[model samples]
Every structure is written in C-alpha cells, then in structure tokens.
Target: MTSFNTIIIQNIVESLNVGLMVISHEGKIIFLNKAAGAILDLDCEQHLGFGWGELFITDEKSNAQFNQVILDVISQQKVGLKHIASYTLKDSTCPKKLSITSSYLTEDDATLGMVFLFEDITEIFNAEEREKKILSRNAALQKERIEGLDSLSQAVAHQVLNPVTVIGGMANIISRKLPEGDPLIHDVQVISEEALKLEGLVAAVHSYCDIPKPIPVVVSAKALFEEANKSANEILDRIGECIEMKLDCTVDKITVGKKLFHTAIVELLLNASNFTMEKITDVSVKVSRSENIITIKIADHGMGIEKHLLPHVLDPFFSTKAKGVGMGLSRVKKIVFEHQGTLQIESPGSGKGTTVTIELPCPDLSCCSKKNSD
Candidate 1:
C-alpha cells in the first residue's frame, strides 16, 4: 500500500517551484509534478501514462534528437545529458530560454527510470548581449565627438595665429635694434620667445586637423634637408642655439609631396628641439631603402620620453608639455597612415634622447601616389 500510495510524496514535489518529471524505460511518463505540468501545459491526472512524443510538440529533427538521447540513457551510453529547447507559441512569441537536464534513475543496481529537470536561463543570456551592444555604441559615439572637436579647433586656431605672428615679428624687430645689455632688450626677447611658443601651439592645432591629399612630385634628399633647416631656424634664432642636419640618403629623387613631406620633417625637427636637454643638441636624418620600402629616420640627442608616456605620445590631445596642445605627433601619425606608411617612436631611458622612424612604400619601385582631387 505504501509503494502504491505515492500521493503524499507527489504532493510534496508538486509544491516545489522547478519542473520535474519521471519517465519509464519505454519513454512513457509515469509521474510529473504541478510545475512540470504547467511548464509543458499538460494535465498530469489525464496525461500520466502518455509517451513523451504525445505530451510534447517539436519539429522532426528535434523530436528525433530527443528520442535518441532517451535511448542512450536507457542503454547506459551516458550518465547524463542537457538540451535547450526553444518553444514558439501560436502567436510566434518566444519566452525565456528553457534548459532541460536528463539523467537516469536506479534502485538496488537495477534501472528504475529516467528523471528530467527544466529551468529558464533567458534573462542572463539576453542581459550579457545587451551589455556588449552598449559598449560598441559608446565607442562609436566617442569617435564622433572627437572629430567634431577637431573641426572646431581648426577654425579657432586660424583666427588666432595671424595676430600672434604680427606680435612676434614686431618684438623680434625691436630686440634686433636695441643695443646690447639694454634693460628693455631682455624683456622684449622674452616676449618674442613666448610668442614663438604660442605660434608653435597654433601651428600644431592646424597640423593635427589638416590632413592633406598628397600631390606627389620627385623630391631629393637635399631638398628635404633644406626645408627642415628653414623651419627650425625660427626657433633656433629665438633660443640662440644651432644643430646640424646629419643626412645619409641612399636613394634620391623619391616621389612624394614636396610641401607635405617637408612639413612632416620640419615638425620632427621642432619636436626634437623642444626636448633638447643640452645647450646644443645633435640631430640626424637618415634615409634607406629595403626591397620596396623606404625608411626615413630622425634621431635627436634631447631629453628622452619617459617609458610610461611613450605609448600615448601620438594620441590626440595627450601631451607632457604644460602649455602644449599635443597635436604635433598626432598630425605626423595621421599623415603617415594616409600614405600607407608606418611610424615608430623609440627612446632610451629619460635624458638619453630618442629616434622617430617612418617607412613608406618606395615610389621608385612602385608608382607615384595618386594625387587627390582637391
């Protein structure tokens, strides 16, 4: 009577939250709790003796897989298996993901039947996917914001630079005429120097935003040297120091933009000058070609970048200088990337100086870069 009277035991399990079912070796369901009946939408009182195929609905492929899994369990092919079933309603609405676990039951070393449990895991999976999409969207928005700021900065810098130049040139003229050791001469010189730094900051803003479409023409090593020297001369005169250009070019007459290439070299020279630790710094420009790639390397004996800060030097608006806008290296990086080239920055420990290298496809081996319509 105790074995046959399972009403009390079944009632206890039926009160629980999770769904549970026990099936015979013939795939016939012997008992199911209230939760299982609700999950499968079955009337446990009327469907207790029904086979799984009659109690549940599924497509042909899934039905076959389900029957095979039950066969494997009965034959002891595996101790347990798990399957996720997605149920679609008549209205085509899908709810939480359902996880079903199937395992065998035994008593006294004899197979009794199989037990199955089900749970919903939809909330957890959907939350994780939503988080990933939010992160991707945030990154895209940040990029757009920075581009907008760059456009605004370029407009403002142009308006400010012209008057700053006039102020600097006037100060230079006054300093040149003043007799040596004049009391006011030193003040004027200081004004001239600060103006020059301001001018550099403005130029950096312009460069950072002004990515040109290159108009390539045949350019020689000597021509590059001259442009760099001329650009650096303004600051050199202000600092009352000089550095020589050490050039070693193996290939001459490489095709590149005359103005843009010169501008990049000059920017490197000015960057070197800004970091000089000595009263005088030595700078060198080296050119070499390997196979179809040409390399231009500029090395300077100046205060080297700190180990930690080197990686961020090319990032827009990231700078060590108190008054700097941090656009110079970013501009150089943009120009190199547009030319299908690579830029590298290398530094020994602080105070040991640094080297900047740029590599581009050799125009002699390849054709000249296509000129932009602009």
Candidate 2:
C-alpha cells in the first residue's frame, strides 16, 4: 500500500501543469519533471547532471531575473515566489513571460538543492499588453481627430476674420457718425461690441491652430516660472485682478520651448484666477522631478469643476464659465501635447478647488551636457 501511494504521488507530480525543477547547491540540475522539460523545451533525461549555466545561458545571456530567484534559494536559502520574468528563447525574437517560484530542497534540516516551480504566463502578459496598446492607440486617434478639427476651424476663422473686422469697423464708424439720441446708435453699438468679441475669438482660434513646433532648449525651470509669473501678473493687472502665487520647485533645469512653456503656465494661471470666487486667490505652483519625469502642479482655491465636466475640460469650446470661450485649456493642451507631455486636472467638487498637473519627459542629464558642449 505504501509503494502504491508513492507511485500515485510521483504520477501527480509528473502530471502537474506547473513546471518543476530541482538544482543542486553546486548549480547542477538534479531533477527536471516532464512539465519542466516541456516548458523549457529540454530533454529531462539528457540534462539531468548538466550545469545551470550550460543549459540556460545562450550567447552570454539568460533569464537573469528567473535564474536569480533559483540562485537565491540555493545560495542564501531565500525563497522567491510568484515572480514574473521575461525569457527570450535561443533563436526566437519574441520573449516569453514566465511566472517563477523557488524554494529550498532540504531533508532533515540539511539543504540538498533548490526547487523551482514556474509556469508560462506569455498569453496572460500578451493580453495585458494588448489592452495597453489598445488604450494608447485610442488616445492617439482621439488626439488626431481633435487636431484635424482644430486645423479646419482655424482655416474657417481666418476666412471669417476679414469680413468680421470690416463689419466691426463699419458699425463703429456708423455709431460715431450717428446722433447721440438716435435709436439706431444703440443697435450699431451692440453690433460693434459683438463683432469685436467675435474678432477676439477668431484671433484666439487662429493662434491655437498656428502653434509652432517647439524648439526645445535646456533652461532653468525656476527662471522660466518666474518669467511666466511676471507675465501672468501683468495680464492680471490689466484685468483688474491681483494674485499672489506661491512657488515651490525642486527641479533646477528642464528642456522646453521657452515661449510655449510660458504660454502654458500663463494660461493655467489666468484660468485659476478667473475661476476663483474669492477676491484674492491662493495659487500654489510646485515643480518636482522623479526619475525621467518632470512634474509641475498648479493648485488653486477656486470654484472647482463638477465631476462630470472634468473629462470635457480639454475639449475645444467646452467651458463652465458664463462668458468663457473655452479655448484656453484646449490651447494649453495642444502646447502640452507638442512638448510630449501629459496634463491632468483634478478637483474634489464645486468649491473644493482645482489642481492641474503637467508631467514632461526629462532625458538624461548627460544629454544636456552634450548639447551644451555642442
């Protein structure tokens, strides 16, 4: 009965879908089950006593992460479990994803070898990758459609501007010539004011359509922010509003188009100023860097957007304000996209305030040095 039970256990182990292998402390393969041989495409009987390096390493390369798990189990008595690794086969261009778990093989507290349990997770990994690619492609297509619309709108605005300007000028002239008590004067004044507003909108649309490709230059981030703040202050002064912006920046330098970057900041600052219901709005600007990303966050104590409207903020001609043309954020979005950056707006709810975060890619510092030398 004991012999029959042992045979049953062996059969169960051999038939497991999970691949299993055991290697000695000296890095020699001691056991390779049928599942392991099939997963690794190796003959278990032929590689029983072969070294790990001889069987796995090819062209001085191997699944270093997967092998390290087993090595740690053998050398340091460390157990690694459920670690995923990318493994490229000997002649295959595509890599396979492997889910590996490793533990010690011991008998009566004496360490004999290491046991590795692993399974192919290529299909699962590929599925996740496909989903990511689909999301990315969808975003790209949406951007293309928006940009195409922008191009068409700009052309229409350009064509309408000449006639609008003539209409506005003629109305203004008629208003100036008419008697003060004339009833037609009021009508002409309304026409003139509306035409001027339309002209301004057309100019804005034209500018948005004609944003030049950025010429990136390495500049001090602080300096750029300071310049943008000064410009924003000037605009605020013109509009009879005063703001005190608090800046906290950790990143020293960044590569960006000066005019384009400044425009992006100024647009956000103006938007923040406009939305705040308070007489004096507190705007906080924080710039930080992590790895290869430069993050700039502008937060404002303002009338925050509704939850449903957050996604449409970047859409052209979408606005929450009564008189807003809704082109500011869309223009900023275009600038951010041209710089290969991402923008996110977050707000808890109405009256809670808003935070706009922009992340730009930062290349290596060495590249900056190279460009400076050149």
Candidate 3:
C-alpha cells in the first residue's frame, strides 16, 4: 500500500502543468519532475545532486531578491508565492518571467527542504512590451505630422501675404490720388481694408506655426509676470467691460525662453477675454515654485467650460468661441511640452470658472552658477 501511494503521488506531481523541483536541506536537488528538468535545460539523472543556483545563471540583483524569497518562506515555515520574476539561464539568450512558489516538504515526523514550483511567463511579458513600443511609436509619429502641417500652413500664409501686401500698398497710393467723393476711391479704400484684414489672418496662422525656440535666460518670475501683464494691458483696456487682470507671483530667477513664455501667457489671457460671460471680471495669474518645479496657474472667472468639450480644448482647430481658430491652446501645449513641462486645464463643468496650470522643470542653480563662473 505504501508503494502504491508513492506511485500515485509521483504521478500527480508529474501531471502538474507547473515545473516542480524538491531540494534537500543541504541545498542539493533531491528530485525534479520531467517538466522541471526540461525548463531548466538539465538532464534529471545527471543533475540530481547539483545545487539549483549553480545550475542557473542569475544577476546579482535578481539573485538576491530570489534568495530573500526562499529565506522568508523557510523562516516562517510557510508557502511562498511570487509572480513575474525573471530567471536567467546559462545558454538562453533572454531572461524568462517566472511565477515561483516555495513550500516545505513534510513527512510524518520531520520537515525536509523546500519544493519550488515555476511557470514561465516569458511570452506574456514580451507581448506587453511589444504593445507599449507600438503605442509610443504611433504617438511620436502623430506629433511629427502635426508639426509638419503647421509649418506648411505658415509657409503658405507667408507666401500669400507678401503679394497681398504689395496689392494693398498700391491701392492705398491710388486711393490718395483719386478725387474726393469719387466712387473708385471708396472702392479702393474698401479693398485696402479687406486686404489688411486678410494680412491679420495670415499673421495669426504664422503665430500658430511659431514653435518654441530654446532660449535659456535667467529672469525673475515676478519681473516676467509684470512684463506679461503690461503687454496685455492695452488689449484688456480695449475690452474693458469684459475682462480684468490680476497678477500674483513670488518666485525669483528662473531659466526659460522669454518670448515663448510671453506668447503662451498672452494667448491664455486673450482666450479668457473672449469666453467670459459675467463681465470676465477676474483674470488671475499666479506663479509659485516647489522643489524643482515652477508652477504658473491662470484662472478666469467666466462661463466655465463644458465637461464634454474641455478635453478637446487643446486640440488644434477645436474651439468654443465664435472667432477662435482653436490653435491658441494647442500652441500653448506644444510650447509647454518643448520646455519639458506640462499644461493642465480644469473646470467645474459649465457655468463655473476655468483654470489652466503650467508646470516646468526648474533649472539647477548650482549648474547655472558654475557655468556663469566659468
């Protein structure tokens, strides 16, 4: 009956999908199933007494982590389980992800060493990594295409505007020479005005194409905020009944591209001015620094953005305003990304206010100081 029981146990162990190995208390392999021997690329008869660690190749880091697992299970005299761990083989070119479990082998009276069960997850990990690479590549390609389209649009605007400028100039000269109250004079003046409007449209397109250029200059945050407010004050004055400006900044020198920062801030202010419903009474700009990041938050007390539409606000040519071409926020996002920063927008649904936050990596002061000294 004992021999029959042994045969049944062996058959059950051999039928398991997982590879199984039993090691003796002295770190010698006492028994390994056929699947275990095949997975480890070993001959069961030849490696019966070999140490498991000596037969497999593992990096120092992975080896230490694996040894800790064994020690923990033995210390508690409990079953141990771990998943998605790499195991290196001497002849295999790549590491394999293995789910491993260790438990004590107990007889009627005494406890032997541990038995280890392993499942290979190499294919699973490889498939996940491949998916990630494909997604990353697709995102990069999309960004490149957007950039190329922006450049082409800018070039077309520039080419069309030069000839338009010449025609507008010639019309103005011809209009001045015409007699007062002449119908032709009025017609020429109207043509010049329309041409100028077209020029403004072309200029807007060029602004959308203007990618941020890297300009590492030291400038105080307070001073930059003041400059941006001063630049936008004239426009705010023109829309006096609809918009208000408030600035609150406290940080010192930060390294950034001045023109790009100014452009982004101005765009935000204009966008706020265009959307406010409750007289646009408060457009606030606040700047603060924490750790290694500089954060700028712009909030507007206006008709808040719709939750459904908020996500698309930064996409090119997606705008809620009547006159907006939808490139302003997209340009803001691109500039922020080029500066190795992030831009985030928040709104408490429709009828509430909207807030946009920009965070950029702060320059290392020590490195800047060393460069200046040199």
Residue 245 local lDDT, model 2: 88
Tens digits of per-residue lDDT, candidate 1, 1-374, equal: 56645887766787877788889877789988888777756687899988876655455644454455555666663556787655433333555456778887878977777898866666776787799899768756755775786789888888889988999999999999999999999899899988888888888787677677788887776777776777777678787866677888876667677777777777888888889966566888888777778888899988998999889988877888897878888887767765667899999869989999999887654432322111
Candidate 1, superposed: residue stretches over 4 Å from native: 1-207, 366-374
Positional deviation of 25 in candidate 2, in angstroms?
Answer: 13
Model with the higher TM-score, candidate 1 or 2: 2
For 1-374, candidate 2 gives per-residue lDDT tens digits of: 57988899889999999999988878899988898887887898999999987877654456776566555555566766557887776667787788888888788988888888879999999999999999899879977986798879978998999999999999989988998899999999999989988987898888788888899998999999888888988888876786788999887888899898899999999899999876566899999877678899999988898999889999888877777788999989889988888999999998889999999988676754554475
lDDT of 3 by residue, 1-374 (tens): 57988999989988877888888878788998887876666787899999866655355655455566565666777766554566666655677777787888888858888888878777888998999999789768867886788878888998999998998999999999998888899889888988887787777678777675668788878878777766766676775644466778766677788888877888788777677765445788888777667789999877889989988998877877655567789888878876878899999987788999999887786654554475
- Residue pairs whose backbone atoms clash in candidate 1: none
How large is the C-alpha RMSD of every model relative to the true structure? Answer: 14.8, 7.5, 9.4
Q: What TM-score, computed on C-alpha atoms, does each candidate reach?
A: 0.46, 0.71, 0.58
Ranking by TM-score: 2, 3, 1
lDDT of each: 0.76, 0.85, 0.78
Clashing pairs in 3: none
